[model samples]
Target: MANPSRVFAAVLPAAGRGFAGNEKEQVLEVHTVNRQSPGDRVREVQVTGTAEVCFPADRVSVCVSLGNSKESVAEVLSSVSRRLEYILQTLRQHGVSDKDTVVRRYLHRAADLYHMDAEVVATFSDFEKMEQVCSVLLEKLDKSVCVGTPQFYHSAGCLSQLRRQVCVSAVENAQQKASEVSQLLGQSLGPPLVVREEETKEWRNEDGEFGSRGQGAALLSHLPHRPTITASSRVSVSFSLRDKSRKQL
Candidate 1:
């Protein structure tokens, strides 16, 4: 037989690597350990957490699309440009600063999606501003009538802060759950064997739907009231186990 000190090797496959697309990563890990000493250990577990923080959204976006069609494509574009300029200027006159007021989307489609001759868009920070701008455009600007949805957004700073707070809360929850499990198993809770993080920011309608009939720009004119913000998050923690068989049991 081999000596007690002889080393052993093992191999295991894992799911894969993570991407930066989301607030968290979806992955599986494989660990291979050699019990070098008498007291060495090997254990595996899976844990997950869902944590979230809700803060009043202070930002919004609006899009206004206008169009015109002359005999030639160039004439149509020129006229459309003129109309959009007026609308954008109207928005600016009403406290919609250059920074806050942006042209969101511009398209030269042979066929108008809204079935209008042409389209242009203006984005704003919130509903109050959007309402004011909307009023001015309807009252003063050309009312050819094909508008897209107005979007709502939050700054990176706000999202980052909320993400941190929610992640910490999730970690705390996972720890509590782990302690309970350890107690039930008649084992002392040990430090976290592994810590993994995940985050999510979801926006839902009042009815809990993923999206609404008029999302972003489309909702601007259709919505009776302004839209609101909705966000959520989740986290996971892993702990090592030493569930040795107790002779008593």
Candidate 2:
């Protein structure tokens, strides 16, 4: 009787079916046989495939703040309100919807003076518009207002899509590998017997800050090291094999 393990191992290429790399792509073939009877033998090939996908940060949030102090509460409120309203109006005029803006105010009396501080945080999907809005606020408000640096990050929907894309790519890679191995063994590829995602990982760039000023400063800041997120998937697939000679008969 033939040794099933040796027979299976010798059928596939020693170099494996796909290109080898640093965990970016991997392929391994596995075979199992049923020894219940020689005529009842079952053969299958299993391969592991890996893939990675990267995406840049899609959303940015900028905070604008102003404060004032006066001997009376009414004076402090009046002074702070003027700048706060101006900031809100500027955001709206730049096509920023109310739902994307958050407003917060704080009031307290320190010794003899009443102090008021207000902040407006706006989220933007359009980078160009964000840059324009930031420039307008900083130029008009001058030293009286503070516009914070832009913070970039990916949205939940973007992350969801990335995961789906990486997984599908990994599966396709596995199928390709299986087909190649099957052809090399003088057999035809059949329907998948099993498909599973073995592992998944995600990471982001270490430096997430973009600080510079220029014509395309907003877009340029992402160069060299943008705040990008990468997702990787490892999938295991098992495909049945059909003998060409038997199928022809």
Candidate 3:
């Protein structure tokens, strides 16, 4: 006997009533005795795509630390406070704002010596000014201030804009691939059924880590090129498919 047409009947739960254990059995059923006209079947195509873009680092961050061993907590604190004030003044004179500086202080007792330390982090957008600032710290602050390696990075607004662009490019890639497959199969591509972001990642320059040295003015010279800031995205998309006959005119 010929197989009956596939029938999809949704038996939803009754008002204020529920089925126990046989819920799956109650919701759907297939019968071979009687047949109804077949309806259009929903179909989907899934594809994965990725995109990446790199931008030059537009900002630099310099970290400096001051440490002093004194007889009493008050003395140590007083000394560190003076050094911090001087550093802040120097940075401000070079066009660095208070918002661009971060200050941290600590006090500890170790091996019968009272250790007090202060750290100052300043960010700069102008490369020449950064160089001037670093040079002045080394010359004026002398051995008391230990300069850290300079960090190269992009501004937050720059990164956020790039991320949005990359995501859009990834989705466009997925749609292109799906359209090609649909064409090959003599089907029409419909609107996306599901669009999802699978992953996002960053790729850094592999040459060497910047500002690895604990003290440096010479090291700054070696950091000639700004580090590359890469933005990347991957997406998994599911698009609906329609038969040739069902395609829109």
Candidate 4:
């Protein structure tokens, strides 16, 4: 009869056949059979997507100030109060609500003179109206009133909408990439298996220009310099892959 060791060596692969003098000590590798059900054998593809969105500043706040000095506290108060009332009245006439206007006053004694300083900070959604109001205040109050430059910013609702929009755009971009990949692999793209926002970034563009120095940037340079906030989002998404032939069945 043929030797059992020689029979074992004949069945072994070429790389595993060279065991001399230590046949009993040599180890054999056994691969476990995969018993996973067909339903559990799902194939997935993962892709990363990113998007950036720029939003112009919408709301504006302007400060209007007045000061008065007199020998008596009552005189100073009367003088400042007259200008303050006029400022509030002007804002109201321009459709500014009381909730959007804030008034602050400070009283101090400089040497023997009583001094009072007051200011009203008003927030406006209408830019044209804001410009008209500023012009009216400067013309009527003249040097008595000082109107600061308008500070532009995005409202809470605007920022919330921006964040949501950027994230959704990133996800859509990822799905597009996955679809192309599936097509290349001769497969059909199914619904998403997993989706996660990997990162988010926000920054202010003080110069109000895009990052690229291309033609788009040159065109934007000629536009009004309204500082903008840019938001970016990156997402990782996994999509299920289906055999195109299986769909017909």
Best by TM-score: 4
- Candidate lDDT scores, in order, read 0.61, 0.86, 0.84, 0.87
User: Which wins on lDDT, candidate 1 or candidate 2?
Assistant: 2
Output the better candidate (1/2) by TM-score: 2
Specify the poorest-scoring 10-residue window by lDDT in model 1. 204-213
Q: TM-score of each candidate?
A: 0.44, 0.74, 0.54, 0.76
Q: Distance from true position, residue 119, model 4, in Å? A: 0.5
After aligning candidate 4 to the native by TM-score, how far in Å is the CA of 148 from where it should be?
A: 0.7
lDDT of 3: 0.84
In angstroms, the error of model 1 at 30 is 39
- Please estimate how well model 4 matches the true structure, expressed as its whole-model Cα lDDT: 0.87
Q: Where is model 2 poorest over a 10-residue stretch in terms of lDDT?
A: 5-14
| Tens digits of lDDT, candidate 1, 54-137 | 654446666676655545666666767777778767776767777665554344446443222444455555567777777777
Residue-pair clashes per prediction, in order, are 11, 0, 1, 0
Candidate 2, pairs of clashing residues: none
Model 4 misplaced stretches (Cα beyond 4 Å):
1-34, 37-40, 209-225
Task: Summarize candidate 4's per-residue lDDT along 111-230 as a digit string, tens digits.
Answer: 999999999999999988998999999999999999997788899988998999999999999999999999999999999999999999999887653445677787766444557898
Q: In candidate 4, how many Å is residue 159 off?
A: 2.5
lDDT score of model 2?
0.86
